[model samples]
Target: MAGGFTTMKTLLYRLFVLAILLSPVYTSDHSAMCAEAATPQTAAQKQKAAAQAKKKKEADKKRAQKKKEQVKKQKAQQKAAAEKQEARAKQQEKAAKAQAQKQAQKQEEEEELKQAWLRQQAELNSSTPKKEVVSLINIGAKFGYAGIMDKMTNNYANISRPNELDNDYAYHSLKGGPGAGLSLTYELQYGAFRFETGFDFTYLNSTSAYEFSLMRRLEQPYGGNYFYITDDLRETRNAGYVGLPIMFGAQFSRYYFMAGAKVGYGLFGNYKQRGRYDIVVKDDALRDPYGLGIHDVPTLAKDQRKLSLQQPSVSLCAEVGIDLDEWLQAQPDKKNKKRTKPGERLPFGREHLHYKLGIFAEYGILNTNKPTGALPLSFNADDPYPQQTNSMLSIADTRVNNLFVGVKFAIQFEIPGKVARPIPAPASAAEISVFDKESMTSLTTAIVQVKNTGNNRTIMKPKTLSKGVIRQRAAVGEYVAMAKAKNYYPESVAFTVDSPGIVVPVKIYMQRRPVFQVKVTDKETGAALAAQVQITKRNDKETAYSMQTDSVNGLSEVMLQDSLQYALHIEQIGYEAVDTLISDIGDKMHISLTPIKKGEIFVMKNLFFATNKTRILSSSEEALEALFGYLERNPEIRIKIMGHTDNVGKDEANQRLSEGRANAVREDLIKRGIDETRIEAEGYGETLPVDTNDTEEGRQNNRRVEIEIL
Candidate 1:
């Protein structure tokens, strides 16, 4: 289009220039030649203009169509982008919601699992049946009397010379002496079963008596000689041994029994003997001739004998004992004393010390006597012939065993076991609080009892102070807390002491008991009437509470439990008595008593009867008694007993029932010491109903017995 426009402008410019040049050459005929030239050029220029205009129009139309297509394509791309973004956003929202739901479900499952675990732990803690096994080291001392059964036999052949001598010997009584021991034991205990092994040092002593006689002949210048000797010997023997004992036993409450074996090696032994002897000699050549001989001669005979105890001794040992720790130190004050701490040694404050008083026996299973052939007595004149004399044990031919039986007292210092140390468990602080459930206020006077559930032991029983809180230290375990106060129902709660050094809070809320306050007054004058008020549980004969209202105030108060019914009886001299069932107990009750006068009606509110019958039920005793007492106190007053019934049956039947019920009351009063003449019976049937017979309560009220004073 631009090139066509430029060509057209050049043609116009050349035509103008040719017209100017021809105007000068043909001035005379310029108009005629110009007109002809203009005509032809105009025709050609018009044709070119039409073509260019058509072409420009076509170009503009094409550009408009291309621009419209671009705009439509851009709008289409924008809509697709928007749709994609919306889809992505929706997907993100769905994923986020799913994730949130999954998280919530996971959290809920975790919570449920946690609650289940807590319940399981609580149940396990409450009913666990296994007792902990304990190991201990005990250092102890024991003292007792030790006696031995001695079996002795004399072998004269081993002690006497060839045929030149005569020998006689007898072994007499053997008596035991004191025995003392020290022990270090390791003990393992599981429930009632006990195992103990340790080292022990024991010392024992005994005394034995022996008698011997010897006669010998001597050759002399006077031809013959005779010698005779008799000796009594008492010997004391001492032995010390170091032993290892393997014991198995059981402990039952405060008593224990142990039976085991002790392997002991004799560390030392010694003996001493002292006594007197009588000696006489007769010679047939001189003394027989003179018919005289040496009489009794006393000579002191003393010697230290050698011990012949074997190297090693095995004994069967048994002990039956009561734990003296349960008795000797059973005093509460002693038990409450400060205990010795770990790694501490206190002379008297060791709480771990256990004492036992027992009867113990050790019978030697292996012969402890090792004898070398030697004479029990020495005839040599040399002062102390220690080598010639031997212990009676060495000369005895039979086996010798040791037996010790006596009361033994022992004090054992117990060392904490690796397992037992875990017990008497770690101490944790507990803060217990008591509050009134209704009022949400502290109960300062509440008594809080904390018990360890595992052991069923009461750990603390304390009355709350002004703060209504008690702070105490308790072992780490499950516990139950109970709170009680006067005029309040007791409350209990369960809690756990899980960690040491942290306070476990226990809150107990107690409900207050219902209180019954009664005021008695005269019906006419409203004057206070002193009355005897006796309250008993319904259907129970024993009085639940009894009190006398003062004449001045006519007030009596008693605290009673909820969800129970009581029978109330009130009586005053010269006034009608009241007997009623107290089921809906409120804060206060007012009673207006009518004086014993003519035509004053008193309803027996507590009286009960059998269904559809006139027979009085046993529950009506209180009402009958009240009426009887009122009649008795006002002896001169006569009473008329009237009965009424609800309209539930035929009129004739109702009338008869009422009449029978009234007569029944009269008879009961008569039997209870009221004069028959003083009581009259009448029936109103359904005509004199005190309340409507429309509802059950109204019907119940309509059926009643009333006493009329006359």
Candidate 2:
């Protein structure tokens, strides 16, 4: 940018210098031309000059008239061309609209036919019964091998035993045991997926043999050192548990797969030990310094006792199986005379049975670790008392987890839950037609609601008319038919069907409803803000009609009543809410909301208190909840409640009443779990008046309670 500026400045300087140099020449040339024109003329020259001027005036007038005529002719041609173009555009637009209407009519007819067919199929399904049997309750039995996984570890060590180190050992091996359970599973199904969960009396048992030895140090005479070992020659742990399994699986044809977890409680446990060991003593000055001390002469020292196991053990199991009942059900049984078909339930006192055989595997994911109350032994034959040499020890540990992998066989009884049979109907058909009165055309895609008014029951759900007609079996009755569609007013027609063989035509027309839209903006800044809008029918107060608007654009498409008037209510926090009446739907409406500023008070238009009391009315619940939600959203903001009354009562009574009302609002908010420090309450009675107290409207305005943002 600097270089460009410098270059531009240099060019401007050169141009200035050039203009200065050419100034003298320009002035000298101008003066010479003036001197030549100032020279005097004779009488003959003057006469020639006057004649030339007369010719020039006539030429100038002719040229001006010619230019004006040319401009008028060009404008006339341009206007004619513009008119032609506009006519062509109007013709094209009319053709396009006609084509679009034709296509829409065709699509509507096709949709009407599809909807009619679907309605007929639904009615038929509802009237018919199933031919096959579905299982409602199931009872089964399952048995599998339970493998005890002994993941031995010393996560906890004994601080009392100085010679024993807990973590210096490892788990060698584990073994599997027999397991069985009685299952009573109730099946919950979702299409092809099935979930099974129930109580089971499961007996889970396993045995584990592992090696985890502890270290011990022994002191000899004459400042000597020695070592002792509490070697586990052969140790066995057995445990039993009762478990509950909740499994989910999917079945495809005859094959299935399942995966889930099982929770169990420990029933019993047994711990057994059989081992022998010797100690190695080291001394430098004595005879036979590398002495091999004999501990109990390597005899069999058997210790068998009951072990305590942790409760509520959890494991995950998976299964894959096939239904054995499918093959059995496929076979023919000549003994049963009421059998209808293959895979069908037989009549009379007969029940269907299903059998399943599957392989399963379960692995315990939690650690069941506890201490074994055994001690490391030290032998000293040189001591006077040989029997008192060994003492009870601490600091040893063990862990036992479980894993089961085997096969399970189950037999389940299925009870049928559905009835399926066909019903007879009339062969002939009757027809109904729908129409549009505004366009004088057959209306398609308009749904028809059929009600048997004579019987006071709905004969059929709303079915769309196909090709502007509905064909169905007719009964000898009077029926009310209603036609409805989006953006169209609903119309109903009553007709009678005398017989079943003939086509009964009933036509109904629908009127089009106009679309309405509204755009909301801020009154002061003309900026858009999200506003809550509601439209309620004047006579029917039970149902509210409303639509959500975009927060950024503050625009919404609202639904309006057909002929009835409605109240449109729109509100935004920190602004005054507005209410207006809408007689009919029209173009987009532009509405502006007045924003409330800090320290500016606004009356709560909908909030009402009892007569001369502070208790709020039930109709004010929605307003209070909205206020609470606003406070929750704006945590840092604070507000003050100010109450006032009209000047009709005693001054002291009025002041006390106003104060009570203001304080009541504050107390209610505090009870709703809002912090008391963020709110303040005050009352001015009739002191700070908003309007004159002479008129009723002014008094009503003065009796309002207001809130000001602080």
TM-score of each: 0.39, 0.33
Q: Which candidate is the best by lDDT?
A: 1
lDDT assessment of candidate 2: 0.65
Task: List pairs with backbone clashes in candidate 1.
Answer: none
RMSD per model, one decimal: 32.7, 29.6
User: Compared with the true structure, what per-residue lDDT tens digits does model 2 show for residues 105-159?
Assistant: 6446434433433444465466452223244345656666776565434463442
Positional deviation of 45 in candidate 1, in angstroms? 99
Judge candidate 1 against the unseen true structure and give its global Cα lDDT, from 0 to 1.
Answer: 0.72
Model 2 TM-score relative to the real fold: 0.33
> Which pairs clash inside model 2?
129-420, 130-419, 130-420
lDDT of 1 by residue, 1-710 (tens): 99999999999999999897678566757777789879999989999999999999999999999999999999999999999999999999999999999979755643543443444445446655346466667676677776544565533532245322243444467777888888888887776798989998888888777666544444543333333334557777888889999999998878999999999998877777666444444556454422123333222234344466776899999989887765554221234322212222323334455677778788888877777755454444322112244566765464667767667666665554422221222235788888889999999998788888999998886556567787877767899988879999888999987854456888888888877889998888887766779988896666989777766778988987677788889876457778977766655888988786787786776688899898899987755765676577568998788899999999999999999999998988888888799889999999998888999999999998887878
Off by over 4 Å in 2: 1-145, 154-162, 166-171, 175-178, 201-213, 217-232, 283-304, 329-351, 372-398, 419-710
Best by TM-score: 1
